[model samples]
Target: MFVLDANNPEALAECLKELNWLAADENIVTLTIPGAGNMNCVLRVDTGKRRFIIKQSRAYVEKYPQVAAPEERVVTEAAFYDKVREIPFLQGYMPRKIGVDVSNKLLAIEDLGPANDCTVLYNEGEQLSEETFTKLLEYLSGLHQQFMKNKVDDELENEEMRKLNHEHIFKYPFMVENGFDLDTIQEGLQSLALPFKNNSLLRQKVEVLGGLYLSKGKYLLHGDFYPGSWLQTEKGIKVIDPEFCFYGSREFDLAVFIAHLYLSGQKEDLIALVADKYEGFEQLNRSILNGFVGTEIMRRLIGLAQLPLEMNLERKKTLLDFASKLILNEKI
Candidate 1:
């Protein structure tokens, strides 16, 4: 149940107005719970015959004015989901977008309350059955292929994206700049100091990422892909939260997905597990896993959104150590 705040009704009302969904008979109730992100409030609206999720975007999330809602990107999201529907292999892994109120940054998505979070699938000691895993791999592989097939070669692109990926996600995270808290991570570890001390190594990784990204053939990639972004239901698995999706390497997405699996300790033979499920996967996806896996680990570690495994030092010391070792060994 979502606790009603004074502003929630107003927010919902505004969103409905923006979406042209403000019907005299429709009843909308704001949820007491907020989503994990900084910019949105989730609400469940019962239209009697059906229900929908309303995500209202916020402007001043954490007093960051520049981080306003990317209303224009909502169009991108809708187009992506529409394209997702066309792929025969990915029929089960995407949601049917109902409507979008881009001006309000409000999205009306298919009600997924009845579906179970995929994280619960792992936590319950039930590995995603081979059937589901195989389906997922095929969907991902096909999605990447379709993305490449759909890209327009002549469109002029903005450099802001590249700058964001490099500066905010990579460079700023590792540096002891005003935005980052370097001492917090460095306090207990001396061996890990080599990364911070050697600027050349950091620059090399950045250059490597740029080169890998430039070789991209895919249309767009979900920069962040983990179980949390998926929900499994009786029908099948549906992916949500494509906010971080961008034009980049297919290996980048695959690596992040694998690392998330490893971090959760869901499977021992990671490559073998994915390889078995994704038929002829090696031909399509060789061990590009080696480079980006560590890059992803470090990106999550020191970056603004560090992994939960790194912060919870007590219970997940082993996981943290593993991540640390990967960061060191891979020099990410």
Candidate 2:
């Protein structure tokens, strides 16, 4: 029931001290929000001795308070952080887990200083370098390969979190009347989106993919592996915010990553290279993978979770058209 309040540093410090995260000698200097906190209450806590990032998940999303989310989601992320403890490479790409307060639903981690997320890729003419993507894709490959199970286990099912994601990604976007106006996001978007949202066949395809997304799978996923989750730090492309993570289709993660690449206007070669570079790409179900990819593309363009994409209506229409075909299993 302990909520993180930025104005009340004293209470936050007291909470940290109680959890043995803030040492007795360390004094809280400042608490600043380091980045766009879409899901949880995140702050960079600077103590006299050291600095770290702390996240607290409440009953609702931090950015959209009306949207309800599981309060124990951060605890699930802590579990993911612990699961990856064995993989040094993955740990290198992610923040070091400092501590977790299960009762209070708080998590503290190493602060990758003054970093910006890959959302900047959404800017005009920006391209993700092959070098940066090597590390990023490698992390994805490793996570899937290392943690893949022969049989699905009950651990980190994260059912509540998955259902919350299910609504936004699959269900919310296509609804005829969701009460959100797309034109508010971008002029002519609603009109551009009308055909896709109204198409019964496309909706069925998206619905099938959504079912697949919710089904338990063998591989571990970053869960929200879009550009926003990939942070560009001084160290490298460090990934963060795995609060939406679950044991699901690896394709779902790759799909989201690739969808963003297309959404951002990254070149065709880079997209092709991504599929080739990932280990076990040859063995992955192409239908399911491409289905997920199309689903992601359609959702981002027409869905509730819109990105900061620098796109014209014509470009969006083109992407939406392509996404529908991909979902329909038509040739690229």
Candidate 3:
């Protein structure tokens, strides 16, 4: 298997040729890194005539090599695209699958030209409008409803990716010393770990949620549904990065989505509107959803995979307090 990067046009060109994407005379016009996903090496490749994305996953994380990952996760991502293609409402919201090379663990997909990820909302203090939020909820509703109470494709059941994500989302943030420098991200932020570490009740709740995350196989889920996975394009919101897709709690996706909205400083009513508009899943455990939301907030705020939020120390502490209450099933 040949490796390709932004600097290696020759390797990429050869790859395209092997995939039959490049004609005999055509060459790559430009190659650039697409986004901040940690799992894969995603590149935007532009030939003079057309553009597409080539994503390849390795045995370890592309962003953090020390963290081990399974190469087969890319195969699972490809399977997710295939399964969703049959669902009419979800077809338009996802990128078109062009080709997949299982032996090399690479995927060629249609490029959503000039679209930016929703992470920019947090990084730049932009807000998701009511209309856009509703659209997102609609997409999620369709996805959850389509597969609810049904047997998911065995090929799409991603246990390795879920275990990897489970560690990050459920276990790591509360650790006193996880080698992540919170002070570097923001001065004195390391002090915030005290409350989480000392609170036995909070840790117990997290353990319960983690158990459910691992054991429950209720509905098919886009396991890592967050701002980074959502793209804002001229056409509409496009969901990506289902490498962590699995059969898990339906509320897990919804909780993660709304947690980012809160962290991005969206209005209370807007957040409430999203919750009200969500018509997915026949049964939802509000307490469990709240626990997942709180855990997601904690992880993003202090875990290894950090977001570019513009919150000060005091505001972060406030959010942390709210997250704790939510996890404890207390009214906020």
Best by TM-score: 2
TM-score of each: 0.74, 0.98, 0.94
Model 1: colliding residue pairs: 2-31, 2-32, 3-32, 147-219
Off by more than 4 A, model 3 = 123-125, 151-155, 280-282
> Residue 232, candidate 1: how far off, in angstroms?
3.9
The order of the candidates by lDDT, greatest first, is: 2, 3, 1
Name the better of 1 and 2 by TM-score.
2
> What tens digits encode model 2's per-residue C-alpha lDDT throughout 1-332?
78898778889998898899887777689988898889999888988678899999999988999999999999999999998888898898999899999999999999998789888899999999999888888999999999999998887899999999999989998998889899999988888888888999988988999998889989999999888898888887899888888888898988888888899899998889986789898888888888888888888988888889888999888998888888899987
**Clashes in predicted model 2:** 0
What CA RMSD would you report for each candidate? 5.1, 0.9, 1.8
Candidate 1 structure quality by residue, lDDT tens digits, 214-277 = 4544456755577767777777777776655666657777777776666555667544687666
RMSD of 1: 5.1
- Each model's lDDT comes to 0.56, 0.89, 0.84
- Candidate 2 lDDT (Cα, 0 to 1): 0.89
- Per-residue lDDT for 290-315 in model 3, tens only? 99999989888878888888788998
Q: Judge candidate 3 at residue 42 and give its lDDT.
A: 92
Model 1 TM: 0.74
Predicted structure 1: lDDT: 0.56
